[model samples]
Target: MDNIFGDAAERLFAQTCTPDVIRRAEQGQPSGDAWRACEEAGFADALVLEDHGGAGLGLADALPVVVAAGRHLCPYPIAHTLLARAWLSRVQRPQASGAIALAPQGLAIDDGRVAGTNVAWARSADYVLAGIGGQTWLLPMQAARIEPNGVHGSLDGGVSWALADAERIDHVAPLETLAASAYTGLIAGAMDRVLAMTLDYANQRTQFGKPIGRFQAVQQQISEMAEQVWAARMAAQLAFQGEDGLPRPLLAALGKARASQAVPRVADIAHAVHGAIGVTAEHDLQLYTRRLREWRLAAGSESHWHDRIGADALASRSDALTYLRTALYGKETA
Candidate 1:
């Protein structure tokens, strides 16, 4: 994974995406000030072509950055922007000046109307991207009504545009898979952070006059959580391996399916290890955990992708092992 973008994003998000900042943003606070810092760091345009005022990096190269965003539980749609900007650039659409978001699943675009429920970062985005009737559409948020969902402002939102004053950029690959692939990277990073946080808590927190981490039961849970986190990371890495700026559909499915499967287990164990504090609104654990659950369901949940993978495997007419190997490694089965 390329650390150059990730390292920069880590530093920027550390300051801009603090727990308090995220908390405020969820309360309908405008994150424009914090987002401006990202703009200054040149992260929002990292994947756009050099000619288009972006770094010209590929989606694979942006994996680490997505992970970094996940680590900090970044409220902005950094994961979406990396791919969206690159896609828009490739199609030569007019540049989006602020944070742009990708909305997948349940999106309805028809007869010049665009609508969706629980669109990620809908309240925060200045522009939105969606696959509308097999064509890429860029809809500015100015004309849309954002109905906030969840407690924290626009952690997600229900958005609708009656007239659909948006541009149909181009017809290309659906953004759902690519969005899910980048999201897996984000999930992995956040899961790793949760693991680290859980480990630190278990080690420092005392039970029966000894560190909880010293207890066999606690240790067992921690070990299980560790395995899940590392497995999720590997899934993201596998999902992100692609040549040009997009991930293979099967790889993306596998990555998202695996990572999403890990979210529930990992979040359960993290809270189990923390006892009560993990669920508290003030604690940072809830921030990451909540996002993890939402992210798992976003783009396509584990069940959704698993069904796709299983259908593909069935369609291949090969043995399970050979089908998996071919899907995973892009190899032809004998």
Candidate 2:
């Protein structure tokens, strides 16, 4: 909620995450410079304790940084890095400077080794954090046999790994919850940028000797886009605020579901408004649109979170209105 931190993040991202930098990253070139700059700016360690070589900022303070990173489409494993730092601090392990990957599911740990397919960003990670049978493990990427798959949208590609006899560590934070929270911020940032681009284009592009924005149909679509972006931003803020001492799953599910569902609608409207140019790689719209779609399915899909929300609501056993109120606002209805 504090613009002090958010504004600083925005300035840093604006300076570091330039279009050239993003273009280089999109071409599969190393983005080490931007990542190092981000680390120097304390973003990589924002979630860790100061005593443990981090900024010691709360989730509220750290999330805006994530939002800024998303807005610029920073070509780094930012969410993964934040989650890894938190896990490392929790387990008292020294944090490494390289990227970290999360093994969400379809992975098994046995005899001190881990074997899994399609581990997100495993090719670039120095460490891979995984949950196994209610316990967490941190595997060294160097020890793993990594096979790179093709890229997934604008985000980095996934990898398969066979890591033998890797080490395991304890983690205090739920990786999924942290990831979902960060992703909510990322989606909000993307939508914000897309809406701005669409608005600018609508006002500048003329049809029938008048700006397209002057037309009622285009105005209505832009209005809907603005509404969705606002809703997504609010959902992300609510999720960030509810991160501490609240029902994390409910808040995360709500934020992520709302934002994810908005992705297709927002992307369609943005592309439609921009005409054929928006779909081309030459245009900047693809950068935000691709990431939005990828992030929507990353931690969990909208359908997945919808099921979780439904299950939580069913478990509450109260009227729908009361449950909705308590879930969204964290206040019980009278």
Which 10 residues in a row give candidate 2 its minimum summed lDDT?
A: 152-161
> What is the C-alpha local distance difference test score of candidate 2?
0.75
Candidate 1 accuracy as TM-score: 0.93
Measured by lDDT, the strongest candidate is: 1
Overall local distance difference test of candidate 1:
0.83
**On residues 134-243, what C-alpha lDDT tens digit does candidate 1 reach at each position?**
76777788889888675453477988886548776646745887788878999999998999999999989998899999999999999999999999988998888775
Cα-based TM-score, every candidate: 0.93, 0.89
Quote the lDDT for 269 in model 2.
98
For model 2, name the residue pairs that clash.
112-165
Alpha carbon lDDT of residue 216, candidate 2? Answer: 99
- Give the best candidate by TM-score: 1
Task: Name the lDDT value of residue 39 in candidate 1.
Answer: 79
